[model samples]
Target: MCVEKTPWELVIDFHGHTCPDIALGYRVAQLAQREMGIRPAPDSECLVKAYTQSCALDAVQVLNKATIGRRALIIEETQHHIYQFHFTGTQEIHQFTVSSDVLDHLKALQHPDLSPRERQNKVLEGVQYVLTLEESAFCQYDKIPGELRKL
Candidate 1:
């Protein structure tokens, strides 16, 4: 008999490691899909614009099927954790920002005194913490202006 893996398990495999950032991204991708009422892209049909480069980006690529190589993902350098998703067929854009409280929690997880292995373990713990959170707890949505919206 075969056992089915949870979506989080698939996300961890695709992301190459487990961390809070990846978990956060997984949640964000899920929320985006729910809000837009869209399924994962079959190919390069969806575009994701991320405001910062982080472990979260990997999860977004995996969960949304939006990849940089396929021109379905865009990374913009910024000091914020904001993401925008655009679907080709509907010309819809969904924008989201990580909540400041969640950001503070993530930042507090980092420590300078821990060994490398200890740090890794702590990050994994952080991932678990994030996984336990409610969707509305970690992020907030931003309204997109009609003029700036694009498919």
Candidate 2:
């Protein structure tokens, strides 16, 4: 006996914008490795894992189109606000979606009370401290408020 099913096309559009916080993480890791001699991130294993997962087909959808014949299932997602081919499937498959967690740390860092100068200084100091073995002279004494520097 043979079985036949109605042809259909399914498209899932996940609409959301990914901010640059992810890039900030990469910058931090790069700074640590370059200046402090810390191990660089996105290690080989993780990179390989990401490539493997991304290359894997997620699903297959039978399309009713006449000329094209059938449409491969697609699972689309946005990263850093760029859209890319997430998954392709030849057979029915399950796709995994990663939801972002609201990082409380970011909230604290983003507090408006910190003047723009202060915020920039914090980012700079944080990066500097993380990337150096010796305490910088600027860090030892009271930090000259970035405001004063402008004056």
- Measured by lDDT, the strongest candidate is 1
Taking all chains together, the TM-score of candidate 1 against the true structure is 0.82
Show the colliding residue pairs in model 1.
91-151
Candidate 1 lDDT tens digits, 15-100? 78778888889888888877867454653266788888988888888778888887788888896889998776554578989888
User: Which candidate ranks first by TM-score, i.e. highest?
Assistant: 1
Compared with the true structure, all predictions reach lDDT values of 0.79, 0.24
Going through the candidates in the order shown, the clash numbers are 1, 0
TM-score of each: 0.82, 0.23
Instruction: Kindly report which residue stretches of model 2 are placed more than 4 angstroms away from their true locations once superposed.
Output: 1-85, 90-102, 122-151
